[model samples]
Each structure stands twice: as structure tokens, then as C-alpha cells.
Target: MSKDSETPEERRERLRQEEWKDNLGGNLNDSLNRGNNGSLVDLVGGLGWKGTGILIIVIVLGFIVYSVFFR
Candidate 1:
């Protein structure tokens, strides 16, 4: 089929292949098997103090706003 006659799905599949690579940069299997991969220290410390603080403040503000406006 000619380029102009290509279906929408064919064009999308071609572009998606170009945009997204199937290759993994490193060994995902080895990383997941590590014991501490999903620990609480990893979870909390990943956010750092500043990020955690800001997230708490934002959630508090959201709750306040919801209470005032919606309830």
C-alpha cells in the first residue's frame, strides 16, 4: 500500500515504535530481586524531608479547601 493509503492504526504503530524502545537499559530482573527494593526507608527517604513536607502541606491545604467549599 502507498503512504497516503496507510490506515490510521498503521501510522500510529509506526510512530509508537519510533517513540518507544523495547530495549531495557539495564537488568530489571536483578534489581527487583534485591531485598530492599521496596522498603519503607526507600519509600520515605526517596521523597527527602522537603518533598515530604511540601506534600503534607499540600494535602492539608486540599483538605481545608474541601471542607470549606464542598461540605
Candidate 2:
């Protein structure tokens, strides 16, 4: 239970939980924690070159479909 005995990850988790608890509302907690896992740039970077290319292709195709039909 002592902070001195806890590992780094444990300390980080404890801090995050404390932050969540001290918030005024659930929305503030949600928004604050939303980017804990990183953002879109992180996602693309994590996907590597091939995966990023595939994702781009999929997005372009989706856009084409939406443009042709919705417009």
C-alpha cells in the first residue's frame, strides 16, 4: 500500500486513478483519459508503412463511395 514500494506502472496507474477520482464529473474524466493510449498520429506510426498504406487506401475508397452516392 505504500507508494515507495510500488513499481513505476503501479505509480502511474495510481496517479491516473487519483486524477479520475478528483474530477468533478465523468465527462471530464473521460475526456482527460481519452488520449492515454495515444492519438491518430500514434496509430498511423504504430501501423508501419504497409498498414498505413492499406489504411489510406481503405479511407480513399470509402470517400469515393460516399462521394459518388451521397453527392
Candidate 3:
């Protein structure tokens, strides 16, 4: 449609709709990134502490058992 044929109110509404769509897309992206980052931090933190503790405990127990039996 020609710009001259479109009413001012229609033009304004169209522009507003475009702006709303753009903002919505941006907000969705931001929310997804935030959630992903939070999940990554939680995963890393959980593994860092729990994994290390379990590993250390297993290693120490293994060493003790080996020394007692094999020595």
C-alpha cells in the first residue's frame, strides 16, 4: 500500500506493532540467556563441590584398603 493512501493512525499503529515485536524478541533472548547462564553456574557449582568430595573419599578409602591388605 502506498504511504499516501494509508491514514496517519494506521501508520502509527503499524509502527507501534513493529516496535512491540522487536522488543518482545529481545526480551525473550535475554530471558533465555539468563536462564542458561544460571543453569550453567548451578551445574558447575554442584559438580565442583560434590564431585571433588566423592573423588577424594573414594581415593582415600581405596588407599587404606590396599595398604591394609597388600602390605
Number of the predicted model whose TM-score against the real structure is largest: 2
Each model's lDDT = 0.66, 0.77, 0.73
Model 1 C-alpha lDDT versus the unseen true structure:
0.66
Compared with the true structure, what per-residue lDDT tens digits does model 1 show for residues 6-58? 87657655664564455444335434654646654445556867888898899
How far residue 64's Cα lies from its native spot in candidate 1, in Å, is 0.3
Residue 34 deviation, candidate 3, in Å?
30
Candidate number with the higher lDDT (2 or 3): 2
Weakest 10 consecutive residues of candidate 1 by summed lDDT: 22-31
TM-score attained by model 1: 0.41
Candidate 3 structure quality by residue, lDDT tens digits, 25-60 = 776776698786765434544577678688779989
Q: Given candidate 1, what's the lDDT at residue 18?
A: 60
lDDT for model 3, please: 0.73
Model 3: residue 36 alpha-carbon error in angstroms? 30
